[model samples]
Target: MLRRLVLTAAASVAALSAAPVAAHADTAADLGARAGDRLTVTVTDAGEGQDGTFDLECRPTGGSHPDPAGACATLDQVPWGKDPFAPVAPDAMCTMQYGGPATAHITGTWHGRHVDASFKRTDGCEISRWDSLVPVLPTTAGA
Candidate 1:
């Protein structure tokens, strides 16, 4: 009886430790893209624990509409201190940018984890609104 008890206890401990691994469950795979006058990105944590280092990208959808390079150039030079288009914090979980027809990628750190997401720009000049919610996984070791 004592031996059985010990074995049961050990088994319980092992199961508890592994529980966390399996606890990371997601019901569905969420992937979407949008673009309009406003560039917006929403990241949902889909891991056992809170995630971190989320990065989002805004890429011109349907293959660079016009000059992809120029669009990016405009975004890069756009002053964050100006109206509407401003530089975001180096560590913002959610972020938005203003520019032309181009996708925006935003990334940040949360709960000691790193995540990445992207969006495609298509319409608007302040009227274009790209909205999407991406799944964020836990940052693995050395990520």
Candidate 2:
């Protein structure tokens, strides 16, 4: 009876180990789907024909943003451990150059976390931060 019980326990363990584990696997697509990533981008004082509020939905990628696909792709390029919306360190040195009057606010959920970030072009660091978001904020390439 002990031998039979041991064999049964071993068989159970084997069956459990053999079961598919894909259900619990957290792939990028799976995480995005579960995260419900969405954002509302508001731009102000940018320039003529540049100020507006837009909606952005990623993963499935749909929204009122002009370049939803590009925006989503750009956002996806941010590394896993980095925060795309992170602000420049206060102690960091930055150029005094002004990019423009452009300013933006992005608010929503990303990667299952809340995001409330602001962008501006008042200085070099701030401009770079704003530009990094590219189409997510709005193209300021030539302007």
Candidate 3:
């Protein structure tokens, strides 16, 4: 009887140890891009109303972005950054000029992580960054 009790106790201990702990549940759930309800993006042009606000949801792809398909495709290319645009090369030079007063804020989830990108057209670099994310951000009527 004692031997049987010891065997049962050992089996119970093994089962308990092998079972996943509660602490890792949340971590496991957030492991990666979950389908059906995993992606969303919001962009505000800082202009004013509807023209400025572009909210998007990918994974099925839908939202206010002018070109949802194109915009989502572009977003797929971004890795992560305060700004997702590639940096200017060390030797390369950017023109020194003001593009405009238009600015934009992008925040949401991409892939499986958070995304927050800021854009402005104050200077050459700013203009490039802003323009680079087109349809995601609308183009001005003229220039």
lDDT of 2 by residue, 43-85 (tens): 9887777789999998788989888999999999988879899
Residue 70 of model 1, lDDT score: 41
Task: Return whichever of 2 and 3 wins on TM-score.
Answer: 2
- In candidate 2, stretches whose alpha carbon ends up further than 4 angstroms from where it belongs are 1-35
Provide the overall lDDT of each model, using Cα atoms, as 2-decimal numbers: 0.34, 0.85, 0.61
Q: After superposition, how far is residue 17 of candidate 2 from its true place, in Å?
A: 13
Model 3 stretches astray by more than 4 angstroms:
1-50, 78-93
Top of the candidates by lDDT: 2
Question: Candidate 3: TM-score?
Answer: 0.57
Give the CA lDDT, 0 to 100, for residue 24 in model 1: 53
State how far residue 49 of model 2 sits from its true place (Å): 2.1
Tens-place lDDT per residue, model 1, 78-141, is 4553322323334644434433333444443211223343433322222122221212122212
Model 3 / residue 3 / CA error / Å: 25
Best candidate according to TM-score: 2
